[model samples]
Target chain A: MTVLDQGLTPPAPDLIPDPAVLDLSAARRDVDATLAGFLDAKEQSAPGPELPPLIALLRRFLDGGKRLRPVLCVCGWHAAGGDGDPAAVTDAAAGLELFQAFALIHDDVMDASDTRRGQPSAHRALATAYTANGGQSDRAEEHGLGAAVLLGDLALVWSDELLHRAGLNVGRLEQVLPLLDEMRSEVVYGQYLDLQTTGRLSDDVDTALRVARYKTAKYTVERPLHIGAALAGASPGILAACSEFALPLGEAFQLRDDLLGVFGDPRQTGKPVLDDLRSGKATVLMALAVQRASRGELRKLRAVFGSPDVDEQDATAVRKILDRTGARQTVDEMIRTRREQAMAALDHVPFPAAAVTALRTIAESATARQA
Target chain B: MTVLDQGLTPPAPDLIPDPAVLDLSAARRDVDATLAGFLDAKEQSAPGPELPPLIALLRRFLDGGKRLRPVLCVCGWHAAGGDGDPAAVTDAAAGLELFQAFALIHDDVMDASDTRRGQPSAHRALATAYTANGGQSDRAEEHGLGAAVLLGDLALVWSDELLHRAGLNVGRLEQVLPLLDEMRSEVVYGQYLDLQTTGRLSDDVDTALRVARYKTAKYTVERPLHIGAALAGASPGILAACSEFALPLGEAFQLRDDLLGVFGDPRQTGKPVLDDLRSGKATVLMALAVQRASRGELRKLRAVFGSPDVDEQDATAVRKILDRTGARQTVDEMIRTRREQAMAALDHVPFPAAAVTALRTIAESATARQA
Candidate 1:
């Protein structure tokens, strides 16, 4: 039986409590410290100089992040009335950060994105490093790509090591492992859908939503919350409550991102406005536009949507079609609906007051942020 | 403390003893069955139709393998005198297979290899699948790489799941987790080294040997043995003995593979002979040839080596240079020396008689095989 099933809860297995119920900003700092300490240990223990370069890259890549998932994880722990010992929850949060790093590094390579967080993407940085190290010019890019893949892999395995080190007892372990497993499979399946759909403009709104749900809704939100709850040895009712709140909020978060990818200022978003359209990112917004487009607009979209050489003028033309077809407005309405639904979920459960406030703040920022 | 450190061993926590002392052939079947069952469960529980194609691809890819790692894992268990149920150990063996699959899939993508085991490599096959699925031709190859990376990742996580599900008790888990963690780091570091060295045509024998040791000897041979021994909660002395025997034998195994990769018959080896040379795989044999080559020969070597267009004539020229420089003969002697050292290690330890025989047979086959 799980910790919740027993008449009495178990004591801390190893780690004693760290300071708990910190506000979001404080929680971010703790997550960062845990990540830094873990990676510092890894670098110190690494056998050769060769690994330092990769480690350095990972540290740099991790420097810029919202830390939303990690913050949510800690909040979830609190929401479940998890008393004492936030250390393991902190480690789990750090692990979520590492997992995100792995996903982004690989995603950049897959998309051939040159920049991330306003710096060179992992592959780009590695390629520059290759050339700086006097590698053959012709082979540098391929070498960079290969190295990035390996680096991503290293990040992934290390994340698991962190999770394993969380000092959870058997009961807690049984609760967490399957949730972690499902998170991994879901994100990968989501990526698979994204890759297959990219470079092809389609009117399949269902697939587009499925992509959003798998990629963002569950992986980015629900799993982190669920993992934190599991770390607390939460009951099934608590986990189900997390899903209800997380799924709609996560979807709204992704919808906001899809909008920002196209319409938001690059200075705030840190990505070119044309990137999503140029890459033909499969999104509900695009699918809706495709569904409603006239023949002339459809032809225009076909010409510009996946074009590598697409100019601002071309993007403007596509944007006009989306506006004209009411697709953008519809997506805006969808976001509102999801945001309201997620807010309703929060009221249905009587979580800690602090956790409720944190969740509300997170939901508002996620749906309303410029970036 | 570990199971061995305790005054007396505890009973099996979950899995009861399966039959033990079976030869490698019988062990292979058990490992295969475990993997099949695990994967079958994954397929059934997967949420949608989208995952089935990827699952099918993985099942097909797994259909071909030597099962050497898994078999050695079982052998290590017996050698360590691990008594009682072999079920957990078998699950661990199966986990090793999935890990190997993960490694090979990503390696193929990194190397951009066209084939593996006489079939289209994972990326190539995945690309074919993408095109077959009505994906645009321009994006199909990229889709395949992304999918393969994801597929490899799934295999990796699933391997961890299998290991977790092995039903080993706390003592076994404590003993096993670190070894597993180290094995992962070592192999990735090895791959990183391999990527840096490939296509450079360096005469750095030390670096080349380091690559071989890290990439092959330790990862392919020693770790599997170590993990198996750990599963049995092997005493430190037995674990040390495993390393002594494994390292030299593993090095020899790699040396033999280096030779066969360039010289073995394609029909037997299931790989085109030109592959290793064309990829400029950093092997001690190549390093030795570079070190000893005349100016004229070095120029010819540079022109033909690492060339995608390298033909049989080019390979013949390289072979002639290798022979004339005494590189091939020197490698053969090195293999002989290492093999002898490994054989001598067997004499120092009083391993189970059956295990010693199995280890000897594996050593002979690994070092002497034509393919």
Candidate 2:
């Protein structure tokens, strides 16, 4: 049998701890450890040394993410009254994180963005390595793009490997698979909608929110919770509660992201403020501002929006229009409303006290944080 | 419950006749019908109308290719003495076809290929649709590339879905998963190796052969057989027999492909004859030509190779040099040797008489056909 064909053993029990005692920070640590061990094993079992660089690149790319999905996944397990044996849930959480890495890598390529998390994006990093290794400079960019595509594909497949090896029983795996499929298709459709709307200014707030709900609300929040809850064999009521609490909080999180993309410090967000403005993302904030703008304001917005040469000065002008239209304040108000709604949904949730407190904390931080 | 969560029913019994009675053309028809039904169901059950275009695009793209992998998978099943229900094997075969679709779509994107199977490549087709649908002309190309990336990702994931729903028992599914993983990794690595070598003239025939073995031989031939054999719980000896026949035949198939890329009629091959030469693909044929060329011939080859502007006159000159150097003849000899080896290996195979006859026919057609 191939090395990969060898049966997987469960992670050490001590690494997982009791779900009742698992806080977000502890969960993050366990998830990180699980990811590290998995990647290490992959490296050791790799067919050749040629793959280490790719594994290293993935590991580095993975290092800087917030691990938000993993934390929520573990929280969902607790929310389902699961009190022990967090190993399987943690494994699934690691799988989600790898899937996120895959998404981010491909997204960066699609956007042609140069930086992610304050580092050269996957394609850019791979290009740098190509040149450093004596590959012709003229071919480096194309090679890097190709390599990044392969890397993303690998991560996507390996994520499946991780999920399958999460040690779930057949029934639990069956329950989780459909949710995973839904999550995957939702995010892809969301990206397609986003791609279609990008570079074209529009005042359709409903379309913007629909994209946000599909791309962020369901993908980033509800699905992970549902997947974890499914692992615990939670009732449909618990899964429905997850949707209620997750959807609004997830929307608020993205709304906050929209504001941060335009106004947050580069040091804080690890991305340039002008990218969203230059791309002319069909964000709710943009739609709101466009809908309410005066003729002159609309002309100014159109002049800077979707321009590849849009600069900090152009961004400053755009911000003035946003503020003058009260779009900034409106987005803030929307975030507040959604955050409160998310918390209010939590009040009726049947989760234990610790889980409820954790979810509240996540909602507050998710909506209110600058980055 | 969600529509996707519903357990998959088996294909109609009539579609999957007794293994001994299976006809290759009938198997192809059944596999195609299964694919059509699966995709139709997916389209109807999609979360929204927005996804129909994507689903339809995939269906059209899948329509044009020869279902080689799927056919080989069934052949392997028969070779493994698999009997009665062919439902699971056919489902897995369909999954292989989707995986191939994913590979080709992404490969076309990486190569910036304008056409595939005599039709516009995925990105090109998408770009045309984008413009036809009134998307901004300037952004259409980028949008197409992004959409194609998403499309490939969707195909990859959906391939996994098809495999999961292939109705394998848990034990059989476990057996198949690692082979699937290895197949995925091998093909990606093969593509990476090809990417690294393309546009750089090299005289390393071994490296070229390595690329062929990994990229086409193993991926296009060996793994599908192994996956099908694994599905039937084939013994090691039977699996080894599959490899003994598949590897050499697969190599000969690629060797024949190299010759066809240069010399075969475009009407027959459905690909431009100049693509490989213009791209300076480091094929075994090219490597042999380079290795044996005189200094003037080498200079002439270098001048036209990898030149996008090289025309029919330059191609004729290159062909003359290739003929003088006997590279074309060498490749023919190589194909003949490998084909004979494949046939010889099959003589010792443990498969039943019908499977043996079918495999011999496949080996001949795969290497000898113009396409």
Candidate 3:
């Protein structure tokens, strides 16, 4: 049976609610408070003083995130007709943020990225901290990488702790756990797929989109909603509805990210514009461009794509080729189509009106964000 | 309350068994079968063809392990008078092995080590595979590292999946999970401490032992036993007994490993003898030697320690000083003492006679094995 068929019975009419509204800003605050309190307890109860710095590093890294997953999770709960103080949902939401911290920290190490969220990435920050603390200068970089890895590991495990303590009753926990596991495996597998395709200029748009689906669509969008709805004992139909809305919007979100990676202003994006070009990310935009490039344009793309030291001039030249080939415009059109599809799906979903409105806002913002 | 105090009532006499006999080798075989089956299912169900190689890579990695943790987990189960068919316990045992695989893969990457279990390390193996597949040779190394990181992440999450599917009743799972979480956090913290002290050698014996306690004693021994016993609804007293026996044995085991790392034959140890010396492992033995070394010995030690290119001659000289300073003999004495303590603890523990005998055997083999 499909996930949508898991709950065969329809919800009683008495259980259905009129459109309900939630104060999202207040929900975010509760999530942040949960996270802060959890970290504080961890620091206070740490086995040794040496652990505090790592915990602090994670806390700082967490501060820069937009809390999108947490927000979506709370929205999912509301969509499923959940009624409560939202304390448990907030705790789970915070856990998602910690998991994201784990992912980004390790991603930076794997990519050897120097910055994140307009600040030094975890490893870079750690390296600077090591030097400031009188460590040998030569060993700072390796030490930072190792420390950040351990920190990431801690975050991953602690995320589990947070979820366990989220106070989900046994039945709810059993329902949530498998989806959480699936989300984790999908994202990791997606990353592996991305790793395999990276640095190789390919026109395999299907593979690129598959990466987007696993890495972004399911992991970033579908899973959080599913998890939150599960916490509310959402019926299979309600979960299916959430997935229907999430997938296309998630894909559009990632596509917009790809465009911003290469074309957006560095100041606005908080990352260098040439990073995607230099890394030769196996993005759908790049694949479309490759599929349609002329011989001279392909040569120019090949010359600078995946180069370690690609320059602004090289990136500008590649952009010209992308625009000339209509790949850029095609991606924009794809985003619009996907966004519309997501909106249409939302219209048919059995969510409260306020929930639908919040999701719509999220979709629009996610696809149109500068950063 | 102390972990030992969790169960206030004594285990009834009827619950105790006479020295129970178990076929440990058979248990190991069963655990291996479980792991193999699980991986087979994962490979068959993977979302894409690209994921098979990673699953296969993990299977091969699993092949090289001694299955020490799995054996300990099963033994803990038996020690706690766990009855009936061992299928569920074996699944949990196999899950522990997968967790070890996760730990080692990341550890190898962090150490930048070239080999494991006499094979190229995961990163190196992936690099070789990448080059063989006609990828750019230079990019192969970075790609391999990235892929290994993802592979490690997958193993970690999949380990959670395995444990979840081990079919413990809800109450039993509740008892086991917190221990599992504690174990994960302790090891990460241990690794973090190790990282902080790795390259900068000092006579900080307490710091070195703390690393051993967290990284090896708790993670490798105590927690596995605790988890297994918890699965059987073991009394707090029994868990305390397990810790009493495990901690010293675990520390001794790590001490033996430190000696092996510097002096064991590569063929027997399945790893190069020069790694610890080259890496400047701030092991207890090294710390003791540093504390007691004379001026000339200190200079010689400084020259060879932490040097990536130290040769046999250099290792030989370092070994001579280790012997001359009595650090080698002192470590041996420390192992002997700790082993005795573990044995003594086993004697007073409330375990079936067979369990106690098996614990003794493990202690002897672990502390004295050539490899």
Candidate 4:
């Protein structure tokens, strides 16, 4: 499991006070249970029987995610001194997971990626479902793509529903809406930038990082924290602190992902290693390699980068070039620096001690985990 | 130029009352202005310059459509006794228009339709933009589709932003949010049902009607009316009346559209006659034809239905079969009946007289208009 999975191991209970308890694993379960319950309600209320299969597909797609955003959302709330029933924020955190599902389903469709988390991507699974349900083979692919798009749309709206239903009191609803809106816009913009940069062997590291900031650092990290903090009626200083802690950790998270996309074991990463190289994903890792590569190496990289037919041998060659150019080392250095920056932000964050401890563990897992 | 395109129309000044004013043309303009202003702020505050082209494309796409839902939303407000400061509902109405844009862009992408409203579809247009920006020709189509998905996501979120910014007060936000959420969910269900039935030649008239009801009736009409009335703190009776009028009128609108897809002139219809036939859209009209066709006629219909290469000649053959089976006349009869039902419902609606008059006009245009 990746850093954010929080796949259900209860934290030892003695260390924290009753009110400010921050159990990451239990939080993940609550988010998942909320998601499952929400979908169950949707399925029941659906106007027709045909909807259930799509809902089922979505349920399956949602199963393996580490649920990073949702976990961080809860962390942000507790960090800002939220107390009493955590139910409303849990619902909002669940909404963040649904939003992540929307983002990933659409992202897979855009990339035409064959698999996600070791399962057929949403579009592929949908296509298979089509033919399995008696659709002509010729129409299966198109049907799958259309269904996936619709599914993603459904997830997005449902996410909004959850967020709206979180039922925060005392006008907190109004306060959090704008933050959520900004989060959605930022992620979409980040995705758009990624689309622009993908399939192009670019040495533009700045644009790549901007994409990461919007797509991952802000979307995956900062916005969820800000939203949760805002829900708790956090002060400006607390919100700022959340951002300072989130941004660097988020970048480190993405940088690790980029590295793993090419270098990590498929069993561990839950994705084929060749996807990024084949799609020419404009990661900072690839950008630095391009910037530093020798002329012959650049030519070889060009031949394989963004090539749809890229295989293990070609990937190995690219890895060799990255190593030779010291680009990999640079990325490693960047990850280390970002991690340090994140850990340093915690020193004077003014959070509850328990929150600091929880966040420290998150930072460690985020920067160092294989998946 | 379909029935909903209140394309800057000016109703006779003598018709609608001042307090219950229903100037379709002016309302459309207000909605457009609101949309433009919102986008302007978004563009100015965007994190980077890359966002504008997508925004521009969306703006151009937003142009020329009849703002039917927005107009109906305002009419619903006025009908339900909303008064003084129509500004909030106007913003909400504009949000409806943005939602329509999101729906249409994604719809075109799903159908792989090359053109919409006589211009290249969003995916196609995005592909052109990619090539124009000197992207490799080979990747242009993929890039276009991906960008279109991102663009559509942007529009959906932006639509939510608009609705959120509508600035309702007095806990009215609570009343309206669920209605908006339901509207979104209903449309998605409709789209999914549409995908399931598309390209499958079937005589399941009930299923086809269900698809149309979800995709068009509730989504296109009832929900917009409900949302507007809810914003005005409409009572349950008023909400029920809105639905009574909306559902039948909405069904009539879809039935009329189905007819136009086949029989109406492309010049007036703003779409090719062959599109519906080519996609094998599971319309009530097609279901009727299939139900009634002679063996030989059914064979001819099946040959052209869902065939991607369907041309004018094939459409003509299919049209002949529809005429022979009397499906075309039956659909016309259904539209007329539904229109009557809508008119009948409006007669007893506890709305102001001006609302009745406005509803009558909408009913007439929705059933009888060409483009």
Predicted complexes: DockQ each: 0.56, 0.54, 0.67, 0.84
User: Where in model 2 is the C-alpha error above 4 Å?
Assistant: A1-21, A81-85, A167-171, B1-21, B167-171
Selected candidate, larger lDDT, 1 vs 2 = 2
lDDT scores in order: 0.81, 0.82, 0.83, 0.85
lDDT of 4 by residue, A1-371 (tens): 12223222234467345555577777888898998999999889889999999999899988977777888899888888887788888899999988988988898888887777768989999999999999999999988998999999999999999898874443587878889889999999998988888888889899988988898899988998888888788999999999899999988888888888888888876667888888788889999999998899999999999898999999999999989988888989999999999999999998998788888877887888776
Give per-model TM-scores: 0.91, 0.90, 0.92, 0.95
Looking only at chain B, model 4 earns a TM-score of: 0.95
In terms of docking quality, model 1 is: medium
| Candidate 4 lDDT for residue A151 | 95
Clashes by residue pair, model 2? none
**lDDT (10s digit) by residue, model 4, range B1-371:** 12233232345677645755567777778899999999899888989989998889999989957788898898888888987887888888999999988988888788887887778989999999999998999889988898988888998999888788774453578878888999999999998998999889999989988987888899888988888888888999999999999998888888888888888888877677777888888899999999999998889888888998999888888888889889999999999999999999987899988777887888887888675
Q: Per-residue CA lDDT of candidate 2, range B72-161, in tens?
A: 888888889987888888888899989988988898888888877657888999999989988889988888888899999989888877
Give the least accurate 10-residue stretch of model 3 chain A, judged by summed lDDT.
A1-10
Best by DockQ: 4
Residue B154, candidate 2: alpha-carbon lDDT? 89
**Candidates in descending TM-score order:** 4, 3, 1, 2
**Candidate 4 lDDT for residue A277:** 86
Writing each residue's lDDT as its tens digit, candidate 2 over A1-371 gives 00100111222356345554446777788989999999999899875556789999999999977788877888888899876778888988899999888888888889888877768989999999989978779878988988899899989888877777663442476667778877887888888888888877889999899988887889888998988888888899999999999999988888888998898887766567788888888899999999999999899888888989999898998999999999999999999999999999999999988788778877877886765
Best by TM-score: 4
**Interface alpha-carbon RMSD, every candidate:** 1.4, 1.5, 1.1, 0.9
Q: Candidate 4 clashing pairs? A: A2-A371, A5-A66, B1-B371, B5-B66, B6-B66
Alpha-carbon shift of residue A46 in model 1 (angstroms): 2.4
